[model samples]
Target chain A: MTSLLNALPGAVSQGLIWGIMAIGVYITFRVLDIADLTVDGSLATGGATCIMLIRAGLNPWVALLIAFAVGMIAGFVTGILHTKCGIPAILAGILTQLSLYSINLRIMESKANQPVSVDKYPLLVSSRHVGGFTLKNPIFLMIIIAIVLITVLYWFFGTEKGCSIRATGANSNMARAQGINTNSNKILGLMLSNGLVAVSGALLAQYQGSADVNMGRGAIVIGLAAVIIGEVIFGKIFKQFWLTLLAVVIGAVIYYVVLQLVLMMGLNTNDLKMLTAVIVAIFLAIPFWKNKIAGKRLGKKEASKDA
Target chain B: MLELINVNKTFNVGTANEKKALDNLSLTLNDEDFVTVIGGNGAGKSTMLNAIAGTFRIDSGSIILDGMNITSLPEHKRAAFLGRVFQDPQMGTAPSMMIEENMALAARRGQRRGLSWGISEAERTQYYELLKSFDLGLEDRMTTKVGILSGGQRQALTLLMATIKKPKFLLLDEHTAALDPKTAAKVLALSEEIVTREKLTTLMITHNMKDAIRYGNRLVMMDEGRIVLDISGEAKKKLTVAELLAKFSEASGHDETSDKMLLS
Candidate 1:
């Protein structure tokens, strides 16, 4: 019990990093109404770019910025494939992802996993705190990540460009009707979505102490699960745009906590995939369940009135 | 002002299912000219609006809006001068967005969209007053998602969105056809109110024989991709639904499938 409690803080920190990725997935899949599969590769792209640049003697912050830029370009290619070439969005994302898989391997140059020397140059270097706790603790790192993500995204979506993107999601036709240049919005949305996913990937790679080929597997699903869970739990409380993103962050943390609890209950790692599918299914059904229940009540009332 | 000179649009050209949606269609709308279009199914009433709105490129034609040759302009570019309310309530406005957000989008027509908040208090107030003209109580529900509204309310909101910026021309493709009779009447009245108050050069397509006769300053009856009957000025003011039907019969020299697809 003590070990579990001790682990909670670290797990939550990790969850926050993943939560940012979840928000990105939510934007594309839910807000933009796009089934973007480009996340998997773009994520590794972010991590690999950061790792490679850092190894080339670049400052950590500069490397992170470069990672974001690289992610944006990757997303932009996917956008062009879908909008200009008239490819289906899902297929466009798939094409970008497949192409990126090769690009990612090339970026790594040598092998899949490249763990930095813990003694020589570990990224996000650890330090001792006033409380004698290592500042490298996952909780502190996640707190910083969550704050940065929530604040930047909150401001970004509030801008005129944000409105354009939102309008694009609401109705592509209307966006065009109002001269909103939906093509740019779609590209921008994918860029923003993938950029955040890449940032999360970079952080995760560093936190886990290495970047692997399959690190981003099922990432899209987890992100989706976090978004759906957050939206459902927060409901109207997060109806405001800024609060909505915050809810997504919280939902991601909760999702990880739930996973931890499942593990604590003695569930096998084999069942994790099943658990994810079931969790996503339950959350997605919330709206449908409410509508069905509401219908039943209305029907019963009508029947009683008739009697 | 909007002008279409010999607009020709053929769907699936050079094939068995090939059909001319717009055939050598020519139309001119003067400033503030409210034109009503009526025809049986496949009369190209909606097609004419789509062509003008640049929904599809015509095979051959020139479309001039406000003195600019917009025939080659894309749909979004042409949308700056034209506002269109679709036959389906779901088409014009995003169902998931708030009423004010949709109006804000419309208000940004012809302007460069930048990085900024979706809607400001000032924009919301402007939208609220604009929507008040609809009399659908939507002005009070500015933050409500349009999906929650009834079909009539959504259509009314859509009309408001289309005209929020006082567009140069407004296209109404049976905007109220999906609503109940009472709601449809309410929306129709709101439509007339906005068109008159804004003095927008508007084109409306209606399936209802009576609605065609009642609204708009000019009435155009389309048959076989052609404007068979054109009524306007004081003469259109005195016309009735029966007279309008007779004119359709006289122009096409064919039986009116009027009963099969006519609304109301």
Candidate 2:
């Protein structure tokens, strides 16, 4: 138990990395009204791209940006498949997900499950500056990345373009009535959303010192879990952009904290999947519970009067 | 303010289910002409409006709005000069968004949308005043999500949003048909107020016969895919619902009871 407490920072740091992907998920699911299954494959796309580039001796920061660009192109293809070809959005996303598997493998060009050695990676694994304390690397990196990404996102959503994108999700015909090209907005929102997801994957690859082709399995679910939990908990406090992002970050932390606690309480590691499903179910059930409980109270009152 | 010259729109052209939605239709609205349109099911009243609004590609037509050749423009491209309200209350405003946010979006319609905080203090004040004008006290509920409002309130908010910048032309497709009677009256009244205040060129399609005559400086009646009767000025002022129905029978040679027009 004490050992798990000491390692709390590490679990939380990983959670922060996943939170970036969660926010990217929020953009598509909430903002664009698209259920993009592409994240599962595109995440590995980012991981593979970053690791391959870093292995080729590119700087991590530069490789990160390149990975983001690659994610954008991937998103653009999905958008085209949906828009130009008239495929249902979910199907288009699936097709992209399917295609990206081989593309990720091609990018890595390595046999599956080959972990990059932390000893040989070119970038700093732990972020420690002279003025600050040493935190397990991803936490510090996420703090910086989250700050920048959230700030930019906060500012962007308030803009005319961002509002239009949101409006596209709310009622697409209304957007068209107001001269908003909703099709373009949809494409733009997806590109941005997927790009962010990919950045997280890039960071994840570096943090774990490895890239796996199937690492992104159930990624959308995790992102959705973080988003729904954050919305339920802090949606009231963070009614708008920046605060909502902070809430997402907090939700990720809470998610990690709960997982760590579960572990400390002697839950088996093999049960993580079931635990994730259970935790998400609990959060998702809040609205139904409120209605059911309220209805029961009303029924009890009515019965007492009738008696 | 808007002109349609020999516009022809055919659905499923050259196919087994081919139905002519509009057939070489020609119509004109003079400056600030408030036109109300009525027709039975599939009578091309909505089709003419959609053609003008660029909802679909007409087979052949020249659509001129305020003297611009807009026959080839797509819907969003044409939306810069057009404000529209749909039959469904859900079509006009974002329910999850605040009334002010919806208004802000309408206010910026047709402009170059960008990644900057576009709403300013002056804009907020202007939006508040606009909401106040609705007289529903929505100005106080500027921050409220539109979903919580009654359908009437949302429809009124939509009306305000459509007219905020006063586009060159307005298209309303049975904008109040979906609301409860009381709420519909309130929204209809609001629609009348805004349309008259702006003296804007307008095309309104309505299922209610009384409302068809209650507003607008002009009235157009359609049969099949063509306008069979159009009245304006003194003629429109003197006409009643019964007389309008009789005129429709005289033109189309079918009793008013034969079609859905009289049923509404």
Candidate 3:
């Protein structure tokens, strides 16, 4: 119990970082209605880019920005493959993800892992400060970033271009009929989503003091888990857009907290991935199951009325 | 004004299911010409509209709209000058969007959408008045999602959206076919009111002969991807469903008539 309490802050910090990636996933999965798998690659791309740039004596902030731009380029490639080349969105993301693996390795100078120690570099956030109550703590910075990101996204989604993108996702036929270039809007959405995921990756690398090529493996599943968890828990309470985004971030925090508790209870770390998958699958199935049960009740009511 | 010269389109060119959807079809519409189109299944009525809207590239054709050649323009590009409502009530507006947001989208159809706010306070007032004019109490539910609306309400909203920003041409592809009879009549009346008020040129496809004759200034009949009958003014005003059936049979040299068309 003492160990679990001691590990709480670090898990929360990690959760906050992954929460940012979950926001990216929400944009593509919920808003654009596309299950974009490019985050698995772009997240590592961001980590690799940020750590490598920082190692080469660049400002950490600027490295993060460049990482975001690179991730957008990755998303742009996937968008083109889907829109221009007529590839299915999932397949397009997979292709970009496959290519990004090679690209991420190249960025790390053919190394599978690279480290940028907090002592040697001016990192933005670090796990070393996780337990601290100061501004230097990753928790403080992550909360601030989450607030700013959600606010900006809330505003952007209420704008003309943003509404058009929403329309494109909701009904492409209606969007095209209303003179919205759905293909361009789709490309823009993918770029924005992947860009956010990259920023999250950059932060994660800074927090962990290392960048690994496999740091972002199965990231889409994690993102989906966070999104579904958020929706299931706070979807009713967070009716507003910004609140929903905040819920996703909180959802990640909850996820990590729960995972910490499970680990303290003697769960093997090797079984962690499978547990996450199962939890996500169950959460996802809840809505479908609810609908089926409701339909059966309605059917029974109509039958009773006939009798 | 709009013109389609020698438009041709064929689907599945090399397969056993190969069918010519459009074949050397040509059409012309003058300013404010409210034309009604009628035909049996496979008569290429909807295909003609799709061709005009640039849903797909034509095999051989020139489509001129307001002195601009738009034959090669894509659907979204062509949408700048065209307003369209489909047969399905769900096709014309984004179901997940608010009613006011859908109206805003329609209001900016031909304009470039930038970083500006999607809906303005002033625009909200205007949309409120527009929705009020529908007399469907939609004014009270401006923030409601369109998905919650009934089929009749959605169809009415679609009509309003299509004409919110006056297009050079309006296309209604059996837009009221999916509604209940009373609701269908209400939507049809709303459509006529909008068309008349806007003085917009339109091509409305209908399975109902009465609606085709009673609504538009001109009537056109198609068969096998070709226009078989064109009537206007006193002649069309005097024409009955029986006369139209006779005319269709004579023009196509077939006694086969769609029972649905007759029944409707």
Best lDDT among the predictions, by candidate number:
3
Q: What are the per-candidate TM-scores when only chain A is compared?
A: 0.90, 0.88, 0.97
Off by over 4 Å in 2: A122-136, A261-271, A274-307, B10-19, B258-264
lDDT of 1 by residue, A97-146 (tens): 98888888888885887765444555773221112367766567677767
Task: Give lDDT: candidate 2, residue B45.
Answer: 84
lDDT (0 to 1) per candidate:
0.82, 0.83, 0.92
Residue-wise lDDT of candidate 1 within B2-114, one digit each (tens)?
88898888899789999888878888899999999988888899999888887788899798877888889888887887788999888888887778777888888888877
TM-score of each: 0.92, 0.90, 0.97
The ten-residue window of minimal lDDT in model 2 chain B covers: B255-264
lDDT of 2 by residue, B19-39 (tens): 998877999899888889998
TM-score of 1: 0.92
For model 1 the local lDDT of residue B23 reads 78
Candidate rank order under TM-score: 3, 1, 2
Q: Which regions of candidate 1 fall more than 4 Å away from where they truly are?
A: A125-132, A285-307, B13-17, B257-264
Better of 1 and 3 by DockQ: 3
Worst window of 10 by summed lDDT in candidate 3 chain A: A236-245
lDDT of 3 by residue, B12-99 (tens): 8899988888878888999999999998888899999999988888889799988889999989988988999999999998998999
Of the two candidates 2 and 3, the one with more favorable lDDT, higher being better, is 3
